[model samples]
Target: MLILKQLILGLLLPAVVGGGIFIFAKSLAWKKESEQKKARLSGWLVAVALSAGYTVGYTGLEGLPPFPPREGVHWLCYLSIIGLISGAFWHSSRWGRLIVQIALSIVIPRLLLNSAFKYTWGQFEGIIWWMCLAVAVFIFWHIVQESFTILPAGGSSPFVYFGLSGGTALVLAVSGSLRLAQHAGILVAIFAASWVITFVRQRSDNNKWQVFPLGASPVVALLLLGIWMNGYFYEEVPAASAILLAIALFLAPVGRIEKIQRLGARRSAIVQICVIALPVVIAIGIAVARSGLFGESSSY
Candidate 1:
């Protein structure tokens, strides 16, 4: 009974409410042209509604007259809801929407669900979990399906938003002690490659990315991952690490292609290096410090 209630409250409720807003936004977009404006409004509405309702439910509602409260696992569940709402609010483009839904569907739920597994079942249970990872894979496949459209230049592409979030997660992971962090780092690298592919496509058709939302995905990824992981990783990001992640995320694209010769584009290499390297260094430092590999705790 409790598990059923939780599933409804955590997954179904947000999907219904948030999905309704998305559908409405789609209708509005079809009627009008300025997708950005409509997207902004829809994003704001979804964010506010989800955040407010989540706060109320987690704090007051939950289990009728309310028992004491489930501890860590339940908190992750609630945070996943918050992350979903925030993702919807943060992204503007259609691709961004698709990527966010993928993250919400897979990353957020898995983080919480995995933690639940650790508590309920002994050990990390990777094999069984891998089987369960069908959920994340399904979400990823759907993201590819719903969002992929031919870029101006060549082939179909996954949304830039997915690349952004995945990249951010990888950067943060590079900065931590966990092996998952390294995998995240690799994913970011792959995503970066894909971003370059997109840039090439856009440039070929003379459509440069005029403005990029810099901090939204990375920041949100960190926040959501942090909350989901119970603050396990990236507790301390070095100044250099933070700067590098920022640069890598911020620049890199224009650096590769001279066609994108905007002011920001000019400094692409520097930014890209900083974005990729700074956070990684910081994360390593933190790991060493925590493990006392260096002196009595090196500040990451």
Candidate 2:
């Protein structure tokens, strides 16, 4: 019963709401280009709505306390909602977009650290970790955003990226923590449904493939947050293994490699898959070895 409720509230409701918004936005604009912008906005709406729905579904409305000391989930839900609103209006200005991304980069990592380690702001180690995480997230944001501009139309679709993310979520679920895995499952549903809507709308207009940060940001946040939780809170998964898995995800952009980029899309994708898989395999091996699932004598 709980699972059914979560599926309906977390997955079904958000998909309907997001799809409805996309269709309505399309109706409001007569021009194809204008409709594309609206579509992007609708994607942002889906990301925010999904985040909110997952929060409410997973942790009841009352689960979140007032403020000051917020949980990791609260930070994810609230920052995502606030960031979506700010991004919608501020996307036109370069500086505004940068400021918003930077704020989220700092806040998300700090919130995770607090939730996991319960470290005070005055602690030097905590501060250093926060700074490092913030920088890593900022770099990831830039990489994803840049991919939209760098990749040719239809070269690498958002669906592919989202699918990769979902796979990572599944991996985390199996090897790390079940609770975090559930959240990742919800995220997969959200992205999959939202991607379908965007793909259909683009097909109707014959538009080129493009993925805005609006759709990508929340997935990035969920992936990073899930990894952190698994590494710090879950005992089965080593912190180093989690970090390696997170780093492996970045290999999707292997097309950027000059030699690889020279290959056709089909070949490039194959290479990218190999690149991404190698590290994931290594991470999983490390986790299994560390866990001593096979035998006590196994070491690596």
Tally clashes: model 2.
0
List candidate 1 segments past 4 Å from native: 1-32, 38-78, 86-197, 210-229, 232-264, 272-276, 288-300
Off by over 4 Å in 2: 15-70, 115-122, 151-156, 197-208, 213-219, 226-236, 288-300
Worst 10 residues of 2 by lDDT: 53-62
| 167: Cα error in model 2, Å | 3.7
Could you tell me the lDDT of residue 35 within candidate 1?
63
TM-score to native of every candidate shown: 0.35, 0.73
For candidate 2, write residues 182-285 as lDDT tens digits. 55555566557657766776678677444443454544454445445544544355665667666765776677788997898668767776676677667666
Residue 21 miss distance in model 2 (angstroms): 4.1
lDDT by residue (164-278, candidate 1, tens digit) is 3354444344335333343232323333333444466467756643211211232234333433243232234444444333333233233345443343533553444444344
lDDT to native, each model: 0.40, 0.58
